[model samples]
Target: MPLRKADVVDEALRFIDSEGLDQLTMRKLGAALNVQGGALYRHFPNKEALLDAMADKIVEGIGDPLPDTAWFDQVRILGNRLRTALLSRRDGARVMAGTFSPGANTVIGTDKAVQVLSRAGLPPAQAGWVSFALFYYVLGHAIEEQAQLGLPPDHDWRERTGRLAVEVSPQYAAALDSLSGTDPAERFDYGLNVFVEGLRRLQEKERAAQEHAAR
Candidate 1:
């Protein structure tokens, strides 16, 4: 059977799921696909290109944005969906960290979110910046979640954190202790809510300022 680019990328993702991002190489991926390493080059050109394709595939789970949604809901939905997709594969976040496709799918998804914000009255540039910030927040949180997966479930980090917090200042230790045992999902939602709320206030402020200038 002849090899196709999609076939190579799909097999590569399965290889990473079993072996992890660190273990992925064209030579190894080709071996998994029952072909020579050189065969992958015809499809990917290099390992970086393959990783970029994998990153794009990870975001495909977001699908197209729904039509006529509130700007805040669009941001929240996309952010949550991106995190879920990254969590679906082993070391998926690490694989996607610096890779972006810049193709039709990625561009359309991103532009749609930014357009939502723009329609909410933010300047186009600010809307774009907010969209990028949401992307970064999702990527950073996913990476942290995946990295923590390697630690023993029962291992206690509280003592270590407490000691470091005390060294910073008494007030810092007290604040850190207050947040102990907070659910990860709750923390994610808390930060996300803060971001969207902050954006709302910012848009309101901008509108007020523009009105003042016009009056």
Candidate 2:
């Protein structure tokens, strides 16, 4: 069977998963596919194009937000889905951060988010900004999460942090200790909840201002 663009992308992702993103190259991907490096250019003009495709693939896995859900819930669902997708592949967040594909899946997901926010009563501009804000929040967190994955299994993050805090700023050690037991998922949910609640409040304030203007 002949190799397709999708096949190339799949192999690239697999290579990334096994060897890490930094080790991926056109030559290696072609070798994995048993073709010359130039053969890849038939599907992707350059390494950048290939990376964009990989990032789109990650976004495609996120699927669509659930129907008939509240806007806040929809936002939460999308945020969680994106985080999971990024974490699924090794260095997935780095791939996503490096490329701006504007591919179909990216466009569809973004449009759906903007539509949800718009329906929640935000103006188009604000809705767009909020969509980007939600995306950045997820991306930033996923990047940090993936970075943490590189740590040694026996790493005691709290202990190290506490020691550093005590050495540099004893007064802030108590605050640092608060992070002792919480896991990444718990922290992610807490941040997401706080963000959504702030958005809810903003929507209410917008509504109240409109009502006042009408009066």
Sequence-dependent TM-score of model 2: 0.91
What's the residue-level lDDT of 185 in candidate 2?
Answer: 93
Candidate 2 ranges with C-alpha deviation above 4 Å:
61-65, 154-180
Local distance difference test, candidate 1 = 0.80
* Candidate 1 colliding pairs: none
**TM-score for each model:** 0.88, 0.91
Note each model's CA RMSD in angstroms: 2.4, 2.3
- Candidate whose TM-score is highest: 2
Instruction: State each model's CA lDDT, in order.
Output: 0.80, 0.88
Per residue, candidate 2 scores C-alpha lDDT tens digits across 19-69 of 999999999999999999999999999999999999999889465747697
